[model samples]
Target: MRFKSLRKSNQVFIFAALLFAGLYYGAGLLVPLTFAVFFAALVLPVIYWLEKKTGIGKPFSSFLGTLLIFIGIGILLFFFVQQLGVFLQDIIESKDQIISYLRKVQLKAADVTGFSLQEQNKLLEESIMELLNMTQTYVSGILTGITGLVLNFLLVLILMFLVLLNRDKFEKFLMMYIKPERQEETKEVIQEARKVAYKYLWGRLQVMTILAALYLVLFTAYDLRHTGLLILFGALITIIPYIGPFISGTLPILFLIIFGGTVEEIISFTILIAIVQLIESYVLEPIIIGSEVEQSPLFIILAIILGGMLWGPAGFILFVPIFSMLKIVFDHTKGLEPVGYLLGNERPGSKENLMEKIKRKIGRKN
Candidate 1:
């Protein structure tokens, strides 16, 4: 018995090490494939609907679904790119205004610090030159990599189409490993995972939309320039969670500072963003995303860190859903319930969090 237990532990450790090695080294191919898989999950129901309602063949329906996904993404990219251009143009046009604002700040700093205006001006010029140089380097890097990005995106689309078309084949392939008695459970796990992926992705989209709407109203009220650009950026960047929101908030404030918005506007915007973030964390996410995935906060953060280490930026967005799906599989598999529970948010003895309780009440009402 002891020998068997030791062998099992060794096997588990070897399997894990091999898995990590593959994930790290195979990222170039795996990242896009993983994205395609999740993207298929997100739109699988739509493909089903098209096939059922339109009485279309699977290939046509899959193609239609993939095309719709591409169109939706293309529209977003179009708006983002267009708005980005407008933002850069506005910045260029306001160069004189920005300089005037900077000069005022320089003078104020000189007065407070008992420094000469010329000295301050010299330092400011150097700082601005450094910033411009850094920006140029960043842009150059992006330009150099643009071809690879486009190719990867095309690969993802193709894979998404194929995955959608052959989903049943994939299901059959998975079932080949399971005993007939457990096949039903395996199917249930797959269905649950699909539902979780769809719900989480859709809920995130809804959150982004609501955030954009809120930002639109706030920016309009403050009479901020390039409101569309700011709103789009603020909404999209929050997809990465903590760091994303920080960048989203910081960029707008930086724009206001550079473009000469009043201090009152800046302060108010900061406070409102904090409030909005609070509401998003405590309210919108819990209600909209629900407890379906039941991922614990610690495990989610760990997953993000591990994913980032393994797969870079894409990992940040993909790992949460991946883990959620894994949790479903774990829970359904015999002897793995403990592992699933460990990944889960619920605790047997602990009281429910405020949001969870509220979610329970809302769910009951629904």
Candidate 2:
């Protein structure tokens, strides 16, 4: 019995290694395909609504849904571009001030470290050359990537439209692999997975929007420089989970530090951001996205790290939902319930907090 258990463990480890290897190697194709599927899932209801209400053909409905998504993306891009212009203009306007600040920083460093001006200038020159080389390399890569980006975008739209149109057929395809007795259970699990993905992504968007609004209002009232760009970045970066939020919150504080803000002003801004983040994490998320994914925090972090390793930035966004869907599959499969529970966010002995209780009440009402 012990030998059998050991053999099974080895098999599991081997399978996991193979799975990760396949994912990493196939990521170029799989990442965009995953995005396509996710977008298809989100827009499926709209397609259904269009078909049922307008008596439109499924193909036309799918096309319209995809077009709507394209328009939305275009709007966001336009907005970001406008804000980016403002950001660049601000920097250009403050160029002299920025230079003055940099000189002060350089002198302070020299004073503290007892380095001569010539040595410092030499070090600076070397650093600038290194940075220029890296910038050249990155620019070349970006030029190459532009073509791939366009092709991937087109692929995603086409795939999304195809998936939306043939969603039922895809369901049938999945059913073919299951025994007749288990097919119904598998179908339920698939539906739940789709629902989970849609809910999580939609909830994330709502959270980001609310956070952006809060940042905009506060930063504007505070008369912060480059408020538009800062607010836009702080909100959008929250989509990447833990590390994203940290960077988002730290950036404005760092900017203030570099630009010589009053101590009181920095402290106030820090407190305000902390409160906003608290509201987002403790209030908005629990109320909006509660139990939708239900995966443990540790598992989500691990998934993000593994995803970054496998698929770069896209993996950071995709892997959490992917793991959540896997948990649903595990929960419904025989002998895998324990694994599912392990991935879940349940605290076996803890009582629900006030925020959680409020979430429960709101969920019940909804």
lDDT of 1 by residue, 1-366 (tens): 999999999999999999999999999889999889888888888888887888999999888878988898878877876776666556556666767788898888888998888888788877875775566566456556656777888899999999988889999999999999989988888899999999988888898898888888877887778888888878887877677778777877787777787878889888887887777777787777777865888888888899999999899988888899999988888899999989998866234545678678999999
TM-score of every model versus the real structure = 0.88, 0.84
lDDT of each: 0.82, 0.81
Which regions in candidate 1 have their CA more than 4 angstroms from the true location?
1-7, 89-96, 113-124, 347-366
In candidate 1, the residue pairs with backbone N, CA or C atoms under 3 Å apart (3 or more residues apart, or in different chains) clash, namely none
**Considering every candidate listed, which one attains the maximal lDDT?**
1
Name the 10 consecutive residues with the lowest summed lDDT in model 1: 347-356
User: How well does candidate 1 match the true structure in TM-score terms?
Assistant: 0.88
- Please give the clash total of every predicted structure, in order: 0, 0
Tell me the tens digit of each residue's lDDT in model 2 across 43-73.
Answer: 8778888889999998899899889777876
